[model samples]
Target: MTSMSFADAARICLTAKYATFSGRARRAEYWWFSVVYMIAAVVVAGICLAAGSVLPGILLLLFIVPMLSVSVRRLHDTGRSGWRMLIALIPVAGPILYLVGMTVDSVPATNEYGPSPKAVGQPVG
Candidate 1:
């Protein structure tokens, strides 16, 4: 696989890995994708508000799975189970903990999820 830049990783997450819940995502990949996701949400909401129609909501729905899947994979990269994503349900602490999880660096070596994405020649799984 070709080496991926931050932009490429974000694009891949939105396209190729749209609903890929299994596998690992590098911190860079997850963060970059998140930035794009937020931007898209803002844009879509603006369009929906301006148009005064529910149609644009469909676009947001389309992204739901990809967002969740990438979040799960990001947790997996930290050697955590996808189910752990449920922590986001708690009032304040949950979101804070989840943010910490996403911000931390990946394990230097492979855990149960797979090889380290930082490994040379290891494609982002």
Candidate 2:
């Protein structure tokens, strides 16, 4: 999982169905994708800030959702509901809660979200 590619990470995110909050995350699979997403966002935001034109600026500003899609997927991979993202709106408590939740490892076996992602990584039984 390179820090720049979105392909594999996107697949992992899509396959993660439930949000029960359990299991281990493959560090590279999740973190690197996050780094790539953040860096791209910063660059895009900078471009929008530098551009003076309103329409073009707004156009450049529209990448937020697609960019964060992977993060949402990562959350799903960790068995977290995508709606949990709304926590960002709660001021300090919001982000703190999100951080706490996102930091928790995945449930050990099956969770509300679906089967264990770890099972997919191991040799077949």
Candidate 3:
């Protein structure tokens, strides 16, 4: 299977799957969108600092759902339940474990979430 592109990943996460907490997401899709989210957050913070406005808060509110959805789907891709994300509610160790789970490679085949997102012969672009 061809790996997904950064642009495609970002597009899917920010638009198509914005609030979709079901299904599976490939590593590239999750990580690339995370990078974009971080960069946008930083930029928004800088702008808010300079302008003394509420842009940062607004941006955070806007992206929170999509971020959570993507994270849940990422977990699903690793064959875990979306509810597993509740582990992040704990202190330090919990967040670390949660992150480690997110880093796991996708299941090669299907689990309860449906077909593998990176399955062979799929058009990934």
Candidate 4:
């Protein structure tokens, strides 16, 4: 797997690739960004609880596009269609299946999306 620093991953997902859904994302890149996203969400939730304000919700809305785009790229890394993200719309089993799919390692080399992010010297973004 390709190694990606948390900062680099966050930078790529939150800025450079904020709405980019056409490329592959390495496991490190995806997970690191996810970690940061979740942390911010938790913090926002806490602020919402403490302040009883809708601003937190609005703040989270800003992340939706980046998160969705990163998720699509992550799926592409696994050689799956970005449309597979719709699977999450299903009930219980759907979320479980979706999580499992995202956890799968990137397909060896590359299928169609592009070259493997794991390829030597491949940049995270």
Off by over 4 Å in 1: 1-6
lDDT of 4 at 36: 86
- Model 1 over residues 1-125: C-alpha lDDT tens digits? 34556688667787899999887888878887788788889999999999998798788887788788889988998999999898889999999988988888888788998887788887654
TM-score of 1: 0.89
TM-score of each: 0.89, 0.57, 0.92, 0.93
| Error in Å for residue 83 of model 4 | 0.6
Candidate 3 whole-model C-alpha lDDT, 0 to 1: 0.86
C-alpha lDDT of residue 77 in model 1: 89
Q: Sorted on lDDT, highest at the top, how do the candidates line up? A: 4, 3, 1, 2
- Compare candidates 1 and 2 on TM-score and give the better one: 1
lDDT of 3 at 27: 86
> How displaced is residue 62 in candidate 3, in Å?
1.8
Candidate 2 per-residue lDDT, tens place, 1-125, comes to 12323556544433442231333344345655566556656676677668843444455344344335544644665777777778878988998887676666756577665564556555211
Among all windows of ten consecutive residues in candidate 4, which has the lowest summed lDDT?
Answer: 116-125
| Candidate that beats the other on lDDT, 2 or 3, i.e. the better one | 3
lDDT score for residue 87 of model 3: 96
Report how far off residue 103 is in candidate 4 (Å): 1.0
Best by lDDT: 4
